[model samples]
Target: MSNEFKDILYEVGENAVRITINRPEVFNAFRLQTVEELIVAFQRANEEKSVNTVVLAGAGDKAFCTGGDQKAHLSEDGLYGPRGTVGLPIEELQTAIRDLRKVSIAQVQGFAIGGGNVFATLCDLTIASEKAVFGQVGPKVGSADPGWGTALLARHVGEKKAREIWFRCKKYSAQEACDMGLVNKVVPHDKLAEEVEEWAADINQMSPSAISICKRSFNADSENIRGISFMGVQSVKHYYMSEESKEGVRAFNEKRKPDFKKYV
Candidate 1:
């Protein structure tokens, strides 16, 4: 929430709170530090009583986010930040977006892959640019988002599609995402901000109290998203502590296929 944010951008507009993952060089993948910044940024938006909606985005017109920072994940602690036992504050960010009462929207441009896809999935709505790509890469990267990225995704796009998404790790185009119910709408890359702002404005015109009730109503039946946050992080944490887990991170950094068979 502080102006000193290095990994992301946070701005409070009259009607909306906009947060952008600012690391374009790595296709906007999140490090543990980046996830920590997101948690604080979402907290900033949640506390803004006047804000009617929150916009989640990525910088440089490429990749809204690509999930955990593989480079940083190479360390001993793997993908954990300073907070939480496992160090991934993703569950907190997801909770902040859901519990904020206001509409949480993902304004995705491109490469919303891995856990980044969960950033879009768990949102109340997703508006994407024509260039946007959505997918899961956890298995390929020696990771997985067993939280909302799995159960909630199944609810959105069905069990079979969700399985294919995670198991196959194939990226989907914006229109494909729309047809699969991953996004609400898609526009030209140049018009993404305009479209998202307009949607936020319209949502702002609605009664905040009413929206709050509606959001809670929608989530009241499903609490597992919050409950399972630790499972994914913990599983990854366990793998990270093992010598076998080194291959994926090493192969990723080296830009080659991970020889998991060697580990087996």
Candidate 2:
């Protein structure tokens, strides 16, 4: 029922598979190994016949995930690793979740910022705790999601609001996120797990084949965003090498505000 891995925990339950980001010490931020492990876990759930739902969560109550580990990325020469474009296999991970047949749910109990916000958005359903906070920090961090993180997000919360989330980099409460259509439900912090289970259980009762078909049909609409992501990622690769980007990382590491304008 449980599979072991560093950075993350994978477990199979009644008809659902749970993948939890386990590095709460850094607020569950992921590094290269973490994303790689996550992809593998998602693939496992995809191939499992009995699994009807996949739950993505973060360990501890502080954060679901805060996006990529800036500290790790900094140590790796400004890249997450030598795996994918932009130094992380982000596109593949996003594809793995989007292309997954079974319903995927984001069980958010705390902060879901940066790429974590993207994860919550991409999930078929997002159930949040009352204490949850959602937002994007790509631009603020001298990085950006470009593709699914932007285009797909616009589809969820609308262009104006999506721009506010990315450009402003401000946080929103669970109710605010729900009202904006980023989250499906928001419950008390302690009841988050129970609420997610009930939602998963309800989903489990549906016909799997039907669900899969509907999921694909829905995806077909915005599939073009994948191309946008490809182009954007290529641009980001170059951006990462710029002083502007490095400044962001430097400021974060130094616990100071980034003087990005000076680099411009």
Candidate 3:
């Protein structure tokens, strides 16, 4: 709602509100505060009468978002500030995006990895730049999004492709992502912003009430994933406490491959 956010930039334009993660120093990685700010921003946009579309983006050219700030999650007591089952309130953030009556678009310019990938998956449509790279790194990092990040993603790209994404943790280029049904369109890197604005303008010309009902109708099919997200995050919280999970983080910070097999 407020434009004075410490971790993100919220701007209201003609008929669209853009929320950009402003943490390029850390690849736009989200911490507790970042997630909280995002939730508030999305909620604000949802309430704004003049807004017909919400554009979710990240600052800088290097990344759209790399996911959770692992450094902030290092402390065992407060994983990312003890706000939710996983200490990130990620479920709430996801729900905020899902429940928004306005059409949501992911303006991805660079890396959309880990939780970032989930955000892209959750949006109503995704417009990517030619430079974008998309993937999941949860298994590699000793974590996994058990709900919408996984189940909803499967719906977008199919179960087998989704499994390959999560299990293999490989990065896909923008064209590859578009080919797989993940991205709606891919434009030149320099034209990314212009492309998103055009799409938003087109959406704004449509009937708001019709769009709202259509969005709700589409969401109804996957509404059950919300419940799955709740319970799955609880399980993730427990998994975070395990040595296996910690190993992943440690290995990441130490710049080495995790020895998850040893834990197994």
Per-residue lDDT of candidate 2, residues 125-183 (tens digit) = 99999999999888887899998889999999999999999999999999999999999
Worst 10 residues of 3 by lDDT: 73-82
TM-score of each: 0.94, 0.98, 0.98
Q: Please report the candidate that would top lDDT against the real structure.
A: 3
The regions of model 3 sitting more than 4 angstroms off are 1-3
Candidate 1 residue runs with Cα over 4 Å from true position: 77-82
Encode model 1's per-residue lDDT on 56-173: one tens digit a residue. 9998978989887887776665545566555666667777777877899999988899878988998999999999999988777677777788988988888899999999999999
Cα error, candidate 2, residue 127 (Å):
0.3
**Residues forming the 10-long window of minimal summed lDDT in candidate 1:** 77-86
Alpha carbon lDDT of each predicted model? 0.84, 0.91, 0.93
RMSD of each: 1.8, 1.1, 1.2
lDDT (C-alpha) at residue 48 in model 2: 82
The TM-score measured for candidate 1 stands at 0.94
Query: Which regions in candidate 2 have their CA more than 4 angstroms from the true location?
Result: 75-77
